[model samples]
Target: MQKIISASNFADIMGVSKATLQKWETNGAFVPSIDPAGRKFFYVEKLLGVPEISDMVQSSWEEEMQVNPLRSYTSIELFAGAGGLALGLEKAGFSHILLNEIDHDACVTLQYNRPEWRVVEQDVRTISFKQFNGKVDFLSGGFPCQAFSYAGKQGGFNDTRGTLFFELARAVKEIQPKVFMGENVKGLAAHDGGRTLETIRNTIAELGYTLIEPRVLKAIFYQVPQKRERLILVAIRNDIADKVQFKWPDPYHRIMTLRDAFFKGELYDTDVPPSEGQTYPLKKQKVMELVPMGGYWRDLPLDVQKEYMGGSFELEGGKTGMARRLSLDEPSLTLTCAPAQKQTERCHPTETRPLTVREYARIQTFPDEWKFAGTLSSQYKQIGNAVPVNLAYAVGRSLIRLFNDIESL
Candidate 1:
């Protein structure tokens, strides 16, 4: 039987106020067991089922996704920014034969960290992947989302020309990999009123690959300590699609907190290593100091809110990100390239400053020793653009499972 904890004790453990816990209970976010004496209590095992708690604990951070038993399987990655996906795949036991990216800084970072990876710094359209036909196991990319020129016809491979996604599909056709994975911002599902994604699905079908129902994986549910989400599209060679079955990774049992990312804890053996970071102007720092942990622009005095928010104060909608300080008690907000940007502030929980570069990397689940190369701004961009390493690991493991099933047949 699982141990039972009192409501107050559970609240303390979660670092949330009792009122907040009650509110969550009221909303059915969590439920507690009742004792015969009328005391409310919760089972730790049951608490793990809560999306916020269970998801974090069971998320991909701690375990290695299953590895392919094959002696060797190669991969080619396109638009491989800062290697978040690549790193996770590597951790899950995939070998990189080639990786292509247009950004010079990202290429430099890749080469700096793993000299073994074949880094092709060039435009995807200009590159020819035909030489690798039937030689690669997987072709993956996080292609940028762009509107397609539908031309009012059934959009297929030809109509997708001029978009980055075309290059991804082109590579899949050229390499003839057993599997291909494409990831993008969640909005891709609804982009252009869903026509764009529908076209992608149809294009993959035309290329003779079986498309799996694409899904949007919320990073938070996958053990990334941020609220980031990505849309994943997978396709398998038609010959073996029926022989293989693919399953998305299970959600973690607990949510990682900001403290888990920064402090010496399960995620890291030691505190974050020292690294360069951007700083706020003196005036901005003073203003931020007044903002408490988990507080945002709304916490500021009326005059301060007006001054800090400028015209945004009068604007409608919840400008929630403004002057937002992360809560140490909870997972951090999704990070952006510019932490101090007014529209998407990610203020440090305790300090009146932006998270350092290493801190940013930690939140993105980058390994501690995985060094980044570039100016501070460039590094921030690299970290911000990376797929959370843990999430990639989960996807990598799933790919391995598919590969194994195919090989066994």
Candidate 2:
């Protein structure tokens, strides 16, 4: 079957620039199949020859969606921001025994949504996990990535001291859950010339767990309408690790777009509800008005581009995020803490303004009913810092499948 995709989406998948894709079409290397709306798209079948792209389009997402835990599985999440991952795990049939966060606003948001949850609001360093030792099935968190000082020869658990990762490792040492997953920005994989990830692997081994091959998952492939990427580190307690294999979740059959996020569609049953959003200054508004949908700073007039980009205009990189307006036909660019910030603008497609709070939530696959607590900026930070709910759900289902296999064994 022929599955159509937009030029930008295809480019992103192919690891080429839109200009490069355009060049290919111009040179007759490959032709795009146009849809009824006169938009260009490529056939999914044609790209199946490429291994990386093939894995994405050939999906078992529907089958994976039916995955359920063999029995009730308990989880304790550290650094739980706004409950995005927690909610996804719950949907995948895991019961949370505890959710910990240091941010007051994020804690309030979690309590507001699920009062029954044991939401612990405090620094993770002060918390004790010994009480839940051997009682939890999973422990998960998105510990902030920090450079480990390789001053000593030992690159084990103690070496990670003073970093947030040390706290996460401490929880694992105490709780000894069957499985634990750590999520972080994709850059974490290559941070500090790969020493950081190496230390993480070594530390997991020291904790008596077998580290699975870590992977970077693209959120767009997991039913989230954003181009965010996260590095996932999953480990199985050594005893259980010997008996079973962990399979990553299948990518969805198709990429969701901002259109699906905003409208009543497969992703959401209702249109994005109105909510507070930031406003651009008069000068900035006028500059953004000239940029077209899916266009960035480069789309502005030559003089405006210089003025808007300032010194960065002469920088070498594409710098595509500046003065950017989202396109309805494509997944949103990864969101940041503030939508109207000059370096990472997320202007609405047709509105000539920043995306509303609800719109930001929608792009991250947050349910319309999941209310965030905080000032407007704090709300945005909580949402922006969160793992996209759908991406987390996909991973959660895979974890459920792993647990089910372990149960059978």
Candidate 3:
């Protein structure tokens, strides 16, 4: 299929400026057809044939292509927001013993989607995982990032008491799973100037688990069509860590885009199914209508720009996300809980509106049949808060491989 790429996206991909692209086209080096509206459309075949583009298209790191679990490995997840991580691991053949989530709507979403799975709808701190000790193969959590209290001691697990992470760390101590992983925003690696991570590292060691130096996994590098990043902290039981080696999941060969998320293409068998979505007010809609696909507020005319960005107009940083439109040919920006938020606008690529609930699900790589149960806002929050399913699947495969190695020995 032909992609009517925005000039900005094309220029960025081809390592040329808009002017340079125009010049190259005039010189007959490479040219794309221009629509009546003056937007450029390029053939995907020609785009991939470029030496620079070809390299990225050729390189692949999808772990499942090479690795498979030896058996039905079991897992339990805490703080399982919307089942993105759970579903991915399920796809990797991990039978979940239990999945815990706090939000009522999210719990319903999970229970509605997977009635057969155990859905614990309570706070993590109140639950005891002792029963599952040494039973589950993996334990995972996308614990919220909260600052630890540095009151009395050198911020160990105690300092993080009352925090959700403490609950995850508690589960690890109680369950003594073979491998435990905690995922959070990339900024966690440097949270509180790295002191927080030091505390987390020390806490994991104290719990008798050895942490593989935490690494941030970019969603776009996997099969996800968003630029979201997660800081993954995977630790192995001290007894087995020495006998096993953990490997990070590899990236997919080519990057996916909004096209893959919304249209019938490689990522989905059919186009996105219509679902509930938010709409902008008349005033906001008019302003957004001026934004070209892939362009942001800065692309608007100066007067409108000044009017639209009253306080932030004089700001130093680009503030590029304001009033932005997504690009069909590029991975979307990290989605926020509210798609229409002022600072982190996630506008649809072709339409001047927020992404639909299904579109948001699609971007996170949730399977088509998995339905979210809640108010529209709740659904968006669940999807936005999720770790992309494809990224989680990639990590799940790596965990399986590591477990396989441990079992072999």
Clashes found in each candidate (C-alpha, N, C closer than 3 A):
13, 0, 1
TM-score of each: 0.88, 0.96, 0.87
Relative to the true structure, candidate 1 reaches a TM of 0.88
Candidate 1 stretches greater than 4 Å from native: 1-68
Which residue runs of candidate 2 sit more than 4 Å off their true CA positions?
A: 23-29, 34-39
Candidate 1 Cα deviation (angstroms), residue 377 = 0.8
* Pairs in clash, predicted candidate 3: 61-250
| Model 2 Cα shift for residue 89 (angstroms) | 0.9
Best by lDDT: 2
Model 3 residue 354 distance off true place after TM-score fit, in angstroms: 1.2
Q: Output the TM-score of candidate 2.
A: 0.96
Steric clash pairs (candidate 2): none
lDDT of 3 at 104: 93
In the range 237-342, model 1's lDDT, one tens digit per residue, is 9998988899888766556678888889868899888877889999998888889888888898889989988888888988778889998756777889978898
Q: Considering TM-score, where higher is better, how would the candidates rank from best to worst?
A: 2, 1, 3
Greater TM-score among 1 and 2 belongs to: 2
Candidate 3, superposed: residue stretches over 4 Å from native: 1-63, 151-154
